[model samples]
Target: MPGFDGACTVNESVKIDHPKLVKLLQLAYSAEKAAAFAYIGHAGSVRNPDEKVAIKQIEMDEWQHRETVLSIMGQYHIPTSRYYEIKYHIIGRIISCSCYVIGWFMPYYFAGRLE
Candidate 1:
């Protein structure tokens, strides 16, 4: 919805041998794993009961996705990203505990929590 779009055509009619495709696939899987980790980490800080439940559901989905990625990665010998930094970890913990656990007033997710 925001980034520039690019178009590329791949002709499957001809058989092509390429070594770069392996690196490309590995990078793609690495990105997927990073995304899954970010979402799972976000779910940990959800406050509302319903939101927490929804996030947990998504966490399960992320786990399954990671398993699939790992399985595919094993075949290609592609190593996954060891860690993904969650920039929101501190704010998330504060908000989740305040609004849900302790019931203290807390800012919403869409608020200026980017810091």
Candidate 2:
């Protein structure tokens, strides 16, 4: 079968065993969700209006990344791990709460380090 660009289509039946890559993508999918959740609290905690908007924008970007990761996983027929989903949700909420108590600088610092 020729692809739209006039090249032969790659065989979909050719399965490549890339456990590490799949694992990394799964981790990324959950991590993006966590980052988005954390950014919500970070935006709320900040006093500066511009900073809040930037943080919210970052949150939206994280969501977009998550969706992209999900789409890739779907293409590969990979399932989302329930353990990772639950774990990251807890971690994200914790970070969100910490953003309120730990002050503003740490959220940016941790976000920078994580990203």
Candidate 3:
């Protein structure tokens, strides 16, 4: 359908075996998997009523993303690990992502950029 956003995309071709393609795919897959787990953990820990609902919705999205990643990996017979070790680097990433979201929206909420 026309004007369906990404339902149809430009058929721009690129080499599938390109290193950059592989790197980007790996990054996206890792982020989705991490987000799924993080949302699950947060959903379990959150106590506020409205926040609980919002978190659950976000968790569902992350779960869907994880499933899509695994489905794509399945085509290549790639293994998707359910038990990967997380290091301190992940904690830093978590903080960074949180900060990014807060930073992006806080200014809009405040109606001005914060200095």
lDDT over C-alpha atoms for residue 114 of model 1: 26
Record all residue pairs in model 3 with backbone atoms less than 3 Å apart, i.e. clashing: none
lDDT tens digits by residue: candidate 1, 4-110? 47755653233224557544544444444444444444555566678767756765664576577666656566555433223333433444445444332233332
lDDT tens digits by residue: candidate 2, 1-115? 5457776666453333699987888888887878888898899998999999988999999899999998888777777888888888887888888999999887776665445
- Rank the candidate models, highest TM-score first: 2, 3, 1
User: Which whole-number lDDT from 0 to 100 does residue 92 have in model 2?
Assistant: 82
Q: What is the TM-score of each candidate against the true structure?
A: 0.42, 0.83, 0.48
What is each predicted model's overall lDDT from 0 to 1?
Answer: 0.47, 0.82, 0.50
Which candidate, 1 or 3, has the higher lDDT? 3
**lDDT agreement of model 1 with the native:** 0.47
* Model with the higher TM-score, candidate 1 or 2: 2
Tell me the spans in candidate 3 whose CA falls farther than 4 Å from its real position: 1-15, 76-115
Poorly placed runs, candidate 1 (over 4 Å): 1-20, 79-115
- The 10-residue segment of model 1 with minimum total lDDT is 106-115
lDDT of 2: 0.82
